[model samples]
Target: MRESASWLAPGRVNLIGEHTDYNDGFVLPLAIEFGCRATVSPGPEGMLRFTSAQEPDPVEVPVADLAPGAVPGWAAYPAGVLWALGVDLPGLTVAVDSDVPLGAGLSSSAALTCSVGGAANDLLELGLSPRELVAATRKAENDFVGAPTGGMDQLASMLGEAGSVLFCDMRTLDVRPVPFGLDAEGLALLVVDSRAPHRHADGEYAARRRSCEQAASTLGLRALRDVVDLDEALAKLAAEPDGEVLVKRARHIVTENARVTDVVALLDAGKVREIGPALTASHASMRDDFEITVPEVDVLVEALLAAGAYGARMTGGGFGGCVIALLDQNAVDDAARAAVAAATAHGFATPRTFTTSPAAGAHSVGAHHAG
Candidate 1:
């Protein structure tokens, strides 16, 4: 086995679709420059050690003891990968460092797991394909971390290309890269971290998923993506008791899926500016129908729109997180200032803002050996 190696995986931002992945629908997401790195090296026999720069304590566990819910906190993410791989190997130590902000609506968890997953695949010569790695990392999250997220984040981290957004079809597991050259068009994509302590491994996110499943079952369809005649579907849902709630949930998924297709077409036609209305409409769906956006995120979106952003919406799993705004390249500063001022006036924490472009996906950065 190699003495040591390190791998890097970037966080991702969903430009349009939200809550559509789990329904086997479409999503448009791009990898961001900020990411996590995992370095793997030999450790004591029969034991695994995991450490993170962002965490206060390192965790050590026996290889046999690695199981779902056995390792807790941030360490579980990396440790879960070892469990999911279901392979026998030597003791190892993984040290991770990252610039991706936690709880900021960026896929920090995916970055962590994918980095570790890539490192393990290389160090062990596992020869796992990118799709298999995506499965392993997502399994680590869904079955181990107990987060009911779809494979969109992991796919984006694994298959992303620089200067493009990934158009993912969750049903078929197909991905195509669509060019997103905002700079060439004198445009900018701004991300505002509301710092509202976004947490998705909770009942709220699960509840939304359950609602979608229930709606799909009621329609006798495989998934919400099969809902072609949305008006008819809503009418059927609205007739049932407490169906109004399901109606709203189902509506968001159908419309959000369409919005993703719309944005992709706009980007394809090189009319990037026209995608603004779709972005705003997406945020409204999440706010009114999906009921995911927190007040601070709502304030930020409104502020950005008021400041002349072409489009703005809350990204990520959404109880609280960041807002992505598309606007003129020169308007970034003014829009950010407006968003922060609006959020703070509502007694919310001051938000952090930055501009980002599409970036490369996970790959090996370096390898080393003991002297």
Candidate 2:
């Protein structure tokens, strides 16, 4: 390891629990092996410099006060991490590279942000715990990048393990790792990229969050996590029909929360084979009820399922992006091939496919700064 070195902040796949985080709900996410790798080194000028494998040039920023929507393009993610890090630790230099596709419904920005934060923590010996890293990265995204994303992605990227799914409570920040080593059983988690991207700053994503807040406030609860199901919530909403926005928001949160709990219980019981149905249900709910899934994503999921996937559905914030499916290992290649052919036949751009496995959380892979 050099005086400074690189760290891997991997992207996450949410098994279930969509659009429920802002409502203080539970989420099941597993960090995938693919993500941003930040190679960092100390700078004599007390400046932060960053470059990405996907970018044309390195973007540089000062180690002082950072602003929201400050730097443009991919640079803002790592730059924002550095700015957020500086609030706790003063200065450093960083360079980032990533395989995680940006805005492809994978938490690429969160990975880069956490990778930079992890590398900076090692370089500065900030002694921040993994939990602290999660908090810092979330702060960076919210305050610096101006994306009001929940902590699920950042937490999964920071606390992931190679063979486990993370069951996290967004309200309490408590995480329990659930083993998902189904590869030996001839089952694999496949991600099919729909090639459609979602923008977090767009009005649609923000509107959903605002709706959740409105619902929580109206219900006299801190968040929707306090509730159990949508039917009970609907009855309350019917008492005040004017609260239609709150009703819709509460519906998504409550139903999604139940889905998360059920999926986790199934995983715990070694019922990996039973998860496909839940996955399909989640996608449909996010699409028809939540109104997040776009046409491209819906088509992709349908194509995958039609091709004999155990279950398939769109993952991420939804306007357009990736779909994940559970498939028999032997059927993976066929499933992927059929998805590509179907996309082409439907006049949609071909999608890429990759096998996903749980990955470890953020850790120091390089030598610490000399004391």
Candidate 3:
């Protein structure tokens, strides 16, 4: 192997909290073993170069010319990170590679963005805090990549610790590290990719975002975070014609925020068994209240649960993607087999199944230091 210093940024699995981060609510997410690794060396000149394990060509772009929509496909994500970062400093070069599957709801783009941002900040000696870096990554995704995603994935990728799940308050950027270490005999965390891709460009996600903003605007709140109680807020919304939609949106945020807190407590007490039921409740609310889970994800979760999985729910933005399940280690094979069988029987490609372990956050490898 060649001598290289690299930064590894893990893709994330949001256990329950979904669509809450952008609302300035809460999220429970963990760094997974599968992620993007960028081996960064300081360029003698201002050039940004990248090659992915999944890409056929090495992409090289000038740091000075970094801008939104400047590249296409996987290249656009890293480019957006650079463009966002370049707003604050002089630019450089980079190389990228990863095992994180793209658009499977494992946050591949966010991982790549975090890896590039972390590498650039380290190698260039930029003194940005993790929170600041997260903001930058969010800006990259929202403005450059145009995803309009929440801050969960980028923040989780930037702040994750090995053997831990992160309890993050998106509004305050305060994080509580919850130990998720499972001994060989303990339960397991399994991720099942539905193989049904997610399309952020589709107006559905953007529409949801707009609805959130409209709710905030109607309530005279800067963001949904200002609403201390969803019931109270819904009562107030009763005067409006769109009260039902706003109520549902508020319901998802409030209930999801509460779930994150509950899950944190469960993990803190080593009550690993309790997480499954919470996952189930969350998926129910997401399906019935939030209406984000598609039939494919519903089938996968149902199949996993039916096979005696501890608990399973659709993960990510939910129109299509993956589901995170908590299962007894012994039952993993059965759960995965059931999920794959269900997807195949439904005429979907057999879902990809794998186990997840907590991984380290972004940091410098060869010649760089943490920014």
Candidate 4:
């Protein structure tokens, strides 16, 4: 309990894939510049001390008491990481600060969990690889936090390189890097935070996932990811009583996975602009078929497109979050103004707009400045 350290983990934005990760589908995501930073030091015996710039009070828990749902609220994210790692962290103090917008589908929870987990990895010398660390973090969220998100967030946060898009295959854990030079290409990635927070533990997310699972089971497959002939699968679903809902869900996952492949290929060809249609199509599938996007998300997408973005789509778990726009760099200001005006006019919270480029994954900020 002597060594102390600081660690950082970047938040992530899924460029094309949505609701597909849990279905064991492919995903294309990149780490954002915004993320969480943690300062950790040894705590008193048998306890982990936790504090956050975002939270008002300090949370303290016995190191041996780490368990699922034991540490409620935001603290459970980090605690779950410790528990999943099977490490006996008797005493550690965590101080978190983040610029990543929570509830905006930017994988802030993953950022927080990985930041603390990375710090613990460094201080404890766990010697886990990027994939292993993310797997532990994923278990923390799934089993400990009880949120059924797939491994994309953690993987992207752990393995993403600056200026690169991570083309990840959820079924295989294969990560392929695609260079992202949007800024240099005279384009900007605009994130319009609709500010309508989404909680993954909510019934809606779990229900959608369950629907996909049932569809996969009904189709005699392990997951929807196995369905190669989507049209044939759609025809098969048409005969079931509640098949329409399941079909829509399956359709979104299948098509979204396809979009991920398309976007990756386009990026590899240095055809960033061509990826726009895939983004927009992905958004539509999520909206019409998956039924995830809320009004705020939908509106922002429309605004971004109207403002001349090559493509605009919601970028998170939906039901509320941010919409991303791929547009000329010079159009960023106009796009932001348009989103702000549109949201405020519609009686929603004023949207937060910002530009981001792919950034580095988790790393230690070092213990030199640790207080």
Worst 10 residues of 2 by lDDT: 84-93
Pick the winner on TM-score between candidates 2 and 4: 4
Candidate 4's TM-score reads 0.96
Residue 78 displacement in candidate 2 (angstroms): 2.0
Best-fitting candidate, measured by lDDT? 1
Residue 240 in model 3: lDDT: 75
In model 3, the Cα lDDT at residue 71 comes to 73
lDDT of 1 by residue, 70-161 (tens): 99788989998888887996899999999998888799998999999999998888999989999999999999988887999999998899
Candidate 3 lDDT by residue in tens digits, 1-371: 12234677889998878888888888888888887877656554567677787889878777666778777777877778767765543434568888888778888888898988877666656678887888888898889988777788988899989888888888887888888866543788889999886644367777777788888888899888778877778888766798888788777777787888898998888887888888998999889877888878999989989988778898888789899888888889989999998998999877889999788877765653435
Candidate 3: lDDT of 28? 81
**Model 1 worst lDDT run, 10 consecutive residues:** 197-206
Q: Each model's C-alpha lDDT?
A: 0.93, 0.80, 0.80, 0.88
Q: Which is the winner by TM-score between candidate 1 and candidate 2? A: 1
Local distance difference test, candidate 1? 0.93
Return the TM-score for each candidate structure. 0.98, 0.93, 0.90, 0.96
Q: How many residue pairs clash in each candidate?
A: 0, 4, 3, 0
Given candidate 3, what's the lDDT at residue 315? 86
In candidate 3, residue 76 scores what lDDT? 79
